[model samples]
Target: MIKKMSIVCLMMLFISCVKTKEEKNFFSNGDFYIDYYENEILIRRDAFYKKGNLKAIIEFKNDKLDNAKIYNGKKLVSQYFRKNDTLYDSETYYDNGIVIGEGNVDRWCREIGWWNYYDRNRRLFQKQHYVILNNSQLSNQVLFYKNGLLDTLRSDIADIVFYKDKGGASFKGKLIYNRKLNEKSYVSILFSDSIKDDFSNMDSVKFDTITFGDKAIMEFPVIFESNGRKNIRGIVVEQYAKEENVGDKPVNMLERYMYIDKKVDFH
Candidate 1:
């Protein structure tokens, strides 16, 4: 009986030593291990590190990766996918795990837009807009200058209305003067009249002509003199009119003319 008791004690000691050795070897190998409760329920486990960096993470079911934190070299790096293993969110970190950036995806459901960018200091710098379009070929683009200024804006729609109902239309173009009104301001008009059934062909009512000042009273005749020099001379006219649609009505008309020196400076 004494010998049998001694053999049992020795066997128990050996088993304990073997278990301790196994635990130590598990940790030394730099691979993560899972822990459990008395009822074999899972609990949280520490992530393994190799060469001062994170290697792998050991997971559990009850208190598992769903609420666990991931680490790399003692720095939190990422959070694992959910229980379904369909999605995973990962984050990059600086040396001290300062959370440089993070990204994730939903693999099971519809694709969600995702974008990320980092700055020089490992911080988020630029974020992109991701959206699904009905036609992938048609996409909106925005441009910016180097100085962060908006230079020009344009769209894929026509906004200018020049003509409608096959009739004549009017257009206005402004000439912004820099210093003085030395150059002429061009004014043009187009007209289309209905005759039998369709409208008349398009025709220009007026063309470019030089003027004085901002008002219409100071008119100048833009012509080329005998000296071959193009001169804008001030001319006065009583009235100017063209043939009207009426025949027997007799459109009343008057005419006047005033001429200015070609070399005169109206400025």
Candidate 2:
């Protein structure tokens, strides 16, 4: 008789947790309530707190998570827009109706295009740009401060296919804008295989400062045959609002390296 009663209680608990094909499921505890639909292609759930205050609400359409909103104590904090489970666009609030940050996501959910960020006071604090490079890889990202001040442009992986059977390791640059006239700049490239004595240009070299129109770029060739380790460390100094070569300061520098066990291949 005791074993039979225990089995019956377990059966009742299981039944309460799930809904039958012809029945709708609802559960509540004081200030919390939830509704579940089991027969839909994509089951949906709606939850609420005291006085029907929506804690979270997900509205699905045609078996897809179309849209959703999340709240904290009746204050909407986040809102998301999705199609087929892919988040396309979304916005987050600071509980005072201030948009914190908003941007677009690619199909793979990698952040793409323009992303806007705001300070707690709702002022435009920063903006970032992401570029999809070769083979759909996210390579370049440029960030700007308020009022279009160029902060930094970084390309973490600058891999490029040189030939059918040859490749090299590379990455994007740390570009800085030189606003002064005839701003001179040079870059130093450092290769990882450098030893204490007798190093060639492939090990390290400092190029002379050169000027360019609106911007100047320094490049060094690092060729490798056997796979080991490779790197290029560079620095760029420019005269900003100072006399020729006077008060010149390094505006930006970059150091990127990668390992190559085989030839570079894109296909």
Candidate 3:
């Protein structure tokens, strides 16, 4: 009799578990709160229309949204937001399921900014930026592209230098090619404007080219040599040639280098 009673109790427990497998809650308006289980553990919850259209879903990992939650409407449009244990910012789409816009919190500034735009298809486009400023007087800005690319950026600061003066005051200059790395161009500008009178006509010349390869190394032409220990000289590109390897073809290249001099005060 004792063994029989034990078996009957085990059977009752199994039935109880099965009953909980299909647990559901219904709202007064007829929306159903549905849940799914795996091995007697709740794994998913969803809300459904009276007509059986899925409206919203909350996925679970130990009863948390380990992945993401999705909200849907009667028109079959759906939007999803990533979640850890809480709902983060998310983007929403139109009835056609095309992304319309998205917004998120700026934890630093506690201010929220959102963007609304359009795509080539005339669909609504949107993005957002949140600013958190450490300094009250300074402002922050963020920029984004339609393709979700970061294009350019600028920020406000308390101090910035518009001009700098060392021993002498102002200088005027034009940029010219000074060197080449591979096929890339590198240029330097010669300052033609200064307050000193020591600069000569050689300083007026600018634009010197430097070639890089096995055939041509590098060369320069001197414009002016100072009389003192320090030389204030202008330089220009002359010519260059690279030696060929045993099995490789020979390569030859040439470049023009120029130099410009400006007045300089020694002391």
TM-score of each: 0.30, 0.40, 0.34
User: How many backbone clashes are present in model 1?
Assistant: 4
Give me the runs in candidate 3 sitting further than 4 Å from their true place.
Answer: 1-20, 67-76, 81-83, 87-89, 103-127, 130-267
- The TM-score, computed over Cα atoms with residue i paired to residue i, of candidate 3 is 0.34
Top lDDT hit: 2
Candidate 1 residue 20 C-alpha distance from true site, Å: 17
Better of 1 and 2 by TM-score: 2
Candidate 2 global CA lDDT score: 0.48
Clashes of each: 4, 1, 17
Off by over 4 Å in 2: 1-33, 36-44, 48-53, 83-85, 105-114, 129-142, 152-267
Residues 51-165, candidate 3: write the lDDT tens digits. Answer: 7777777666775554334455555443444433333455556666666655542312122333344464654433333322222211122334545543433211111112223
